[model samples]
Target chain A: MIEVKELVKSYGVTGVLRGLNLTAPNGQVLVLLGPNGAGKTTLLRILATLTKSDSGTATIHGMDVAKNGELVRQSIGVVMHSPMLYGDMTVSENLAFFARMFGLPSPDRRIAELLQRVEMDRRADIRVRLLSHGQQKRVALARAMLHSPRTLLLDEPESGLDQRARCILEGIINEFRSADRSVIMTTHQIELGLQVADSVAALERGRVALHEPASAIDIAQLQARFSEPTEALGAL
Target chain B: MAEFHSERGSGDQTETAPTSEQQDSGSPGVFVASLGVIWAIARKDLLLELRNRDVIVSIAGFVLLVFAIFTFAIDIQQADNAELVGPGVLWAGIAFAGVIGLNRAFSLEMERDTLEGLMLTPISRDLIFLGKALGNLMFLAISIAIALPVFAVLFNLVVFRLELLAIAVLLVIGFSSVGTLFAAMSVRVRAREIMLPLLFLPVVAPLLLASIEATADLVAGDSWSEMSQWLQLAIGFDIVFVIVSAVIFQFILED
Candidate 1:
């Protein structure tokens, strides 16, 4: 479980997250929806321990992120805007490096399994620089899933994924949910995000404008919420 | 949607494979774990260099170019000033070439945002610094090893002495120790090429001075006692740089 309270963050004079509160329980997919500069990536960065909040508390499995960063890192996998991969390294090599870092007992076996699952086993020897954007995204996903992190924090994970990789991604998220793990992903793909989300939360002006079960909101309503003016959702 | 197979395939799951809980239950000692992380990072760097040959090639080229230019400009055949200018030329060549290696030490990580990937690992930040520093030291040592003979032939000087080799090692150590730290700090800057030297050169100046003095004394056929003071200063600088840089590396890496 991941819980955040009163999270406030800023850059220079610009505020990104302002006393924001959120909770993501285990065994569910919480899709975060927002426009540009809406603090989605900033929020993920804080949760991933890449960026510290100016003031607030974020905990994963009751371990404070600020105080227990390494512990929190061990429990979470992050896929940011960039693939976060070494372009010069082959797919298998990249996974092996991360596996060793994670101190996995059987890296070769785990790497082979992940490569096959991600449908990149055939291209295991190909360098990341040689792969297409979608292919690289697949490898990035494979890298993220290497350590079997309990929480997967994906930011714009579907940006370059083709239809087949999207299916693979959906399958992976479903698998995580089935295993009672938590997935907190941010995306602009309304249909795909809603399709796999157990719940949806919309962010406006560094605050949660709306939070509800996925069943309570459809594509049209979510689109309307996003397209409508920010002032209209002030009371939300 | 096609079903993605389970992570644990029938033949893929092994008893040797440890879960997170199992890993915690039978974890190695902290020292061993740190060594493992450091080795993993360094090996990755070595492999990347082997594949592309960019960093080593650039460093080797730069060092050789410096040596060639210095030999012509100094006109070492004059024989009277060989000892005086030889040590300066050698150290300058190495100092500048070392910067080339140091610049790539972290910029490679920045190119594809792999540094953040590294930061996400469970390993401590100091281990990352040590690993990169170790890799940089090895690259500099290798480049210098190759360049020394070339330098000797060009300058008509003997650089194969034990004392000189030891001084070279110290130079490499001191350069990489602080170089890696500043490299990480300046990697994100837009003009990192300019920023690295601006941040690194001044700090390493004293160590360079000691190394040059020791090398000059050694080349001039002076007794050990004559150069002993300079060697001590170099050694002291290396020790302090490595410790202070390693301790504060975490801050340089943090946002």
Candidate 2:
């Protein structure tokens, strides 16, 4: 679903991604577990075609993300911070706009189905600004799914959600895999990430320090590896 | 149906999935669909403005207050020669209000971080520029409508003439063309509010001078045919600036 190699991205002297390579195949969720400033967001942005890498090759399926950005955009769904939704528009209005943009057929029916799936049908008419943070987050989730994207890239989906909201997020991720869609997500939560992810990896110092199946690794060891800084980071 | 298709170092066969973009782009009604995206973006902005009433109301209030103050402070109303002063005061007030409106064009996107969402749509940046510039132009036009009667009464001048309307449209279109581009650039920097006017003054110096002079001529009873050169200059700049700004805007908005 996603393939990246030698992705070196930097901001002036401060490097964010250094020779990072990772992959997430179809029908699975890949969770990137990392500490603060681990370049997880930058990696996702590259895959989402929201930002360019300084050097390296990253492709979704086979299309180069930088060269075929328009095609890549048409295939993937993205969830970033703060919902990325207009506060003044109603939830339904927001979905309808994207639906039209995606050239979705039968948009009203699709909007209804997504809203019902997210348990947000009751509040579809309410303005986004009036909703609580969790509700707005749910709307954001629905908006991302409105186009039925094949690859889902979410950056920190569990940041401020309540337990119920987190469960909905996990359910959505699971549903993606069940439908043969691939998922790439970044989070610091070990237990929650492992529960939903089929594969797990840790990014440190702009490099992938570890990549393994979630079922193979011991949780405690995984936590320890993620928490400590690597002395080999500078050398790499 | 939406699986990824990649090209590796060597020839390799992978599961081929068709791209919907080719289908959509090749369809018979693509032009209409493109227009739909443009109108959707512009409509969202206008609706947001209508709901908040921030930019238009504040701009109108500020411009009207400036006009009234200039009328009293400069005594343009009592001048034995109001024409000489009226155009200067009018353009200054309009220019100030226009800048404030333009500055909000991209700051609102930055405020909500909705820019990334727009980018992900893969809509052409040229269309984004057109939609935003149109929205800015509409807001300025609304402000002008609200301020005109009050401006005329305060300065004791006739702002209802056809030539005045023509000059106003040309000025607003020219300002919006350049202002939208600068506003997009300035919002990415710190101190965007101060940055907006500073970037604006130098770029629009010639346009503003022509605008003020032309307004002075019309107010001084010069016929449109007589001031054809000034009108032609404004029209020419409007064409060149708008096209140039639209072309250059995509570079400024790069991720």
Candidate 3:
């Protein structure tokens, strides 16, 4: 389980997250819905142990995100909008490099299996520079899952992907769910989020405007919640 | 069928059991794994350079050109002073070529966003710095190997002396060590092409002077005892800069 209590994060003079609280239990997908500059990326980066929070406590399972960052990194996998892939290397080589960095047991087989899972086995030998944007995204996805992490934090995983690529991604997320892994993804694709997310949290002015299960809210309610304009308020 | 394939794919009997140990010990294995990561990055760079031949070729060509220019400017054959001036000419060639290679080495990473991917991995930033430094050192060594013979042939100097060889190694170590660290820092800054040489040359001036002096003594056929003090200074510079660079590289990289 992940519990964020009174989380507060600021950039210079501006506060992005203001006493925001959220909870996500195991075996559930929580989609954070918000428009631009809603602090969605900031919140996810903090959760992924890439950025720091000014004042708050985020605990993954029982470990504190700030105090026990290495532990948090070990348990979580993050796939941001940027592919974070080396263009000069082959697809399988990229996966193997990451797996080796994390010291995965049997990295060779793990890399091969991930390639097959992402359905990039046929192009595994080709340099990433030759692959399309969507193919690179698949490789990035496989790279993120190399360690079999428990918590998956994806920021715009479906962005820039075609319909076929979107289906491949949805299939991977469903696989994560069946493995009993917890996932938190932020996406603008409301239809895709509705199809897979078990719960949804909408953010406005760095606060949770709506937090409920997907079954509890219909499409109209979600649209209304997301479309509400944020007031220009000073930092808390 | 999917489940069966997943189970068989893992090949571990404990595939059904949870990997609780890994979760409990979050980073115990990471430190050891970092060594492998460092080796892999350096190996990849080395292999790529070997295949493409751009860095090596450019460096060698640049060194040869510098030597040729110096030969015309200095009139080596007319004067019996070739031996006295040979060391300065060789170091000038190496230093100029070293800067070019260092700049190109780092630009390779910047061109493709490879450095970003490397940084996102769960390894210490220092290891990344070290790996790149090692790669630069190897490339510089190769450049020296090709240039040293050309220098001997062009200047009509005997190149097979043990003292000369040792002094060459020391000079290479001093030049490339500082070059690698400064190159890593400068590559990320704005206007990096102009910034790298400006940042590197000033900081590395003392080592360069010391190397040129030591090499001049060796080429003059001075005894080891006579040149020992200068050699110590060169060694001291290399050790100090390498340690300081390793400690401060993480800060630069983070910024």
Candidate 4:
């Protein structure tokens, strides 16, 4: 459901995504693994229609990202490291606001369902700033799913979560898979990413260094390959 | 690994595809939906303002400070002239102090960078601008409400009367329409606090002059028809600036 072709994006003289291409089929998750400054977030931003690529084109569900951004926006749900919610507003308020933004029908029921799905129904009235990081992530998750978007885009979702929180996060990711929805997530968590991805791609220097079915490569080999020098990997 | 281009129906553009804006404009309910989104967003902003009370408190304190300082600075000997100049000083203080509140209005969104999050929604960017502008207008209304009584007693100015209050509201809306637009633009700049007034003041000079003239007329009990041109100028700027700023807002709101 997500597509990119020979995309080149840059900031001034610095190139972030240089002649890159990627595709993730619907009904599975594609986790982008890369080190810091590897343009993972840049790639996701382009797909999210938040940033326009310098050249080439990216489309979500076969519509040009730059030209059809509004449709792309409606189809995709995004969760970044930040909760992207008002700290002062209650959990229910955040969801209600977003529900209204999406013009969802019967928002009260939808908000209730989302809060319950994220296991945040109990704290619905509590202010978001008062919630713990894990709790905030839970609320954030509920906010992202409120619109029932066809595609999910997550950036560094597990950045600060503990093992238990990671498990919860993984469960949310797994839920998307079971529903046959497309998910594109960018994270540095190796084991967790591999566990959820139907296909995995590793980015190096803004180019896909490795792309394959998750079942084709074990975590041990992936780790060892990742540790090797850049020169060892031949031309793409 | 080879670059992962799709094997099925990737490059071929969808035949039925229409831009989301086109879809929205084509829809009959688009106007109502946009209005709903605008009001919903504005309500969110108002809720945040009520919770923090930070912007309101700052504006109130600064407005009072302006009044108190003006009271002490104006010699009792020049009481008549001070009363004559009161309307201008009152607006000057409110405009300057209110812009501070406007500058901090989006600070909540700046914390988690939620503006970009709003951009990801299907709502048009102009609606977000209107929502925020309305929220700021509310803040200005609150400050002016408090200042009206205090401004009268402190400076011996006759500003609380109905006609003058109407003029105040019109001028406030005019100031806020452009003020809110520039505040959003300035908040993103590095030197934002300094940038806001520098960008805001010059554009608002005509409205300020009209406000002073109209308020002067009301204070002097001059014929309403005599102040018609000033009222027309104020209303004209209010309508034109609001539409222009609403349209221009979309261009500035980008990731």
Candidate 5:
């Protein structure tokens, strides 16, 4: 399980997350919907331990993120806007590097399995720079799943993916849910998010504007809410 | 099949996870594991360097340029200045060229945002520092290895000696330890190229001085024992900075 309470973050004088509160139960997908600068990425960064919240509490599996960062990191995986990969390295080499860092047993077997799942096994020897954006994104997803983390935090993961890659991503997220793991993803693709989300929350002005089961959210109304006039962009 | 994979993948993955006992007990298992992580990082760096030759090429090119410029500027061939100033020039040149290598260390991480990927791993920050510093030290040492012959030819001095090798190791250690830390700290700054030197050079000034003195003594045919004071200074600098840099690296990498 993942829990966040009274989360606040700021860059300089601008506030990004202002006392936001959220909870993601295990065995489900919670999709965060927010306009640009709504702190979606910032929220994921904080949860991933890539960045710290100015003031708040975030815990994964009952361990406080701030206090048990390394332990929390062991259980959580993250994919950001960029692929977060070395372009010069081959796909398999990239996976092997992370697998070694995570200290995974039988890393070669694990790498091969992940590459097959992501449909990149054929291009395993090709440098990442030679791959298309969608291909790179798929490899990034493979990298995140290398350690078999209990929670996956994906920030705009679908940005450059094609239809086929989108299907693979959905399959991966659904797999996470089926295993009783937690997946917290932020996306601008409302339809795609709603399709896979068990729960949905809309973020506005650094707080949860709306939270409900995915079945309960009215997509048209939710879209209208975010489209309405904004005071200004939040700090990104 | 998906269910099986997910279930198998879930949980602690304790095969590699460091237990509190392993950490506190300082077991051989933990020690070996730490070395493995350090090697993984260093190997990744080595692989990248081999593919692009960016860091090595830049360091080598810079060292050659420094020697060439100093060779002409000092005009040491006309007088006995080669024996007197050659050691100082060699150390100074290596020091400045090293900054180029250090600057690229973290900047490459910033380029594709892979640093965040590394940060997400469970390993401690000190290990990461060691791995990167080790890679940087190797590059510096290699450049110096190549430059020594050139230095000997340009300055007309015998640069090959066991004492010089010992001093070189100390110099590289001191350079890399502090260089890696400052490089990560300044990576995000707008003027990082300028910022790295400003941050690194002043800190390594004493190490540079000790190194130059020791090298000069070696060039003067003094025995290694006679340069003990300068060697001690260099060794002390390496130890202190390596410990301090490794300990504080976590903060430098923190958001």
Candidate 6:
């Protein structure tokens, strides 16, 4: 299980995550909701072990995020809005490269399976630069899963996906959940996140303003929660 | 929500996923893995450059042209001057061509956004730096090979000996190490073209100076005893830069 206690991160004089605390168990998806600059990305990055917290403890399983960052990284798969792909490489080439990086056995077979799962097997040989935004996202998803990580952290994963691509992404998440992987996804697409997420957490000015089960929070309540006036002084 | 489990099952785990304890047990495995990653990056870059041909051709052409210019600029027929100036011209060509190659080494990664993608992989940052450095070294080495023949042909100088070869290798290693390190730093910054030369030249000056003197001594057929000091200086410069660059590279690579 992922456990966080009073997680705090700051950039110079500006604080991002302030005493943020949350948890996600296996076999479920936790959707993080927040507007821009609300520390959602920072929190997720910290969880991915890409960024460090200033003054709190974040433990993935029982390993401390700061002390056991490599362990945390070994267990997590991350997909950022950037897609973070090599445009010069073909989709299949990119996947194989990451497979080798993560030292996956039978990388070729695993790559084929992921491409087929994402329904991009036909375009696997195409260079990533030629792929559309949705196609690139699919490739990124496949890249993330190369190691078969137990925890998935996606930031605005559905932003550029078309309806079909979105459906494929939802299916992927569903499959991960069924396989007992814990997922923490951040997105502004409220209805889509609501549909798939087991729970929702909202951030406002670096604090968790609202967090509850998806069933417990209605659309109106969610919308109103985001509408609350963020204190200007605290908006750094 | 389901609970997150820290203990991952070993059955489906790939060989890359060594348990945390194994990873922490001395770091030899990590080092070996890093070397593998570096080799892959260098190999990939070399394959791409072989296909593209622009960088190799341009750098080789530039080094040849620089030698031609220096031939006219310095009348090598004068024995005293030829012995003193030959080393300078050789190194000048190398340094100039090296800068050109290093500048373009990361051009592909930056243009294609491959750098960001590489960073996201669990590979250590040092591996990325080493890989890029090795690729730059390969490019520079090839340039040196071509330039050496061209220098001999253009200058009408027969300074190609075993000692000279050793000095040339030392010089290239020193130049490429700093070149690769600074290239990584400049690739991520704005005004990179301006920034790279600015950062590289000052740091690499001592090595270049030492190399030129050593090369001059070798050309003069001076005994190893007399030239040993400059060779030692080159070695010292190379080791210092490599260690410094290895430690500092992560800072430059981190977002």
Determine the backbone clash count of candidate 3: 0
User: Per-residue CA lDDT of candidate 2, range B103-125, in tens?
Assistant: 87677877877767777765566
- Model 1 stretches astray by more than 4 angstroms: A228-236, B1-28
Every candidate's fraction of true contacts kept comes to: 0.48, 0.32, 0.17, 0.41, 0.64, 0.26
Taking all chains together, each candidate's TM-score versus the true structure is 0.92, 0.90, 0.83, 0.90, 0.96, 0.87
Model 6's alpha-carbon lDDT is 0.78
Q: Candidate 1's residue-wise lDDT over B1-255, tens digit each?
A: 112233332211232222333344656655566676777788888888888877788788898999898777776778567888989888988889888888976778888989899888766677788889888888888888888889888888877898998898888899988999999888888999999999999999999999999999988898789998998998999999999999889887766
List candidate 5 segments past 4 Å from native: A228-236, B1-8, B15-24
Worst 10 residues of 3 chain B by lDDT: B10-19
Q: Residue A69 of candidate 5: its Cα lDDT?
A: 78
Query: What digit string (tens of lDDT, one per residue) describes model 5 on residues A125-191?
Result: 9999999988999999988888888899999898888778888899999988988898999988788
lDDT of 4: 0.78
DockQ of 1: 0.41
State the displacement of the C-alpha of residue B17, model 1, in Å, after optimal TM-score superposition: 14
Interface DockQ of candidate 3: 0.24
Candidate 3 CAPRI-style tier? acceptable
Cα lDDT of model 5 by residue, B150-238, tens digit: 98998889878888899999999999899999999899999999999999999999999999999888888898788999999999999
Better of 2 and 6 by DockQ: 2
Best candidate (score: DockQ): 5
Give me the candidate number with maximum TM-score: 5
Off by over 4 Å in 4: A218-221, A224-236, B1-28, B76-79
What's the lDDT of the predicted structure labeled candidate 2?
A: 0.79
Order by DockQ, highest first:
5, 1, 2, 6, 4, 3
DockQ for each numbered candidate: 0.41, 0.30, 0.24, 0.27, 0.56, 0.29
Poorest 10 consecutive residues of model 6 chain B by lDDT?
A: B1-10
Model 1, span A113-187: residue lDDT tens: 888888999999999999999899988888887777778999989888877898999999998899788899998
Predicted candidate 6 versus true structure: per-residue lDDT over B1-255, tens digit per residue: 111221222213544633335545758876576667788888877866875765677678888888888788888787676676778888877787777778887777777566766665666666777787887788888888888887877766677788777787787777777888898889878888888888898888888888888877777778888888988998999999887887788777654
Local distance difference test, per candidate? 0.83, 0.79, 0.75, 0.78, 0.86, 0.78
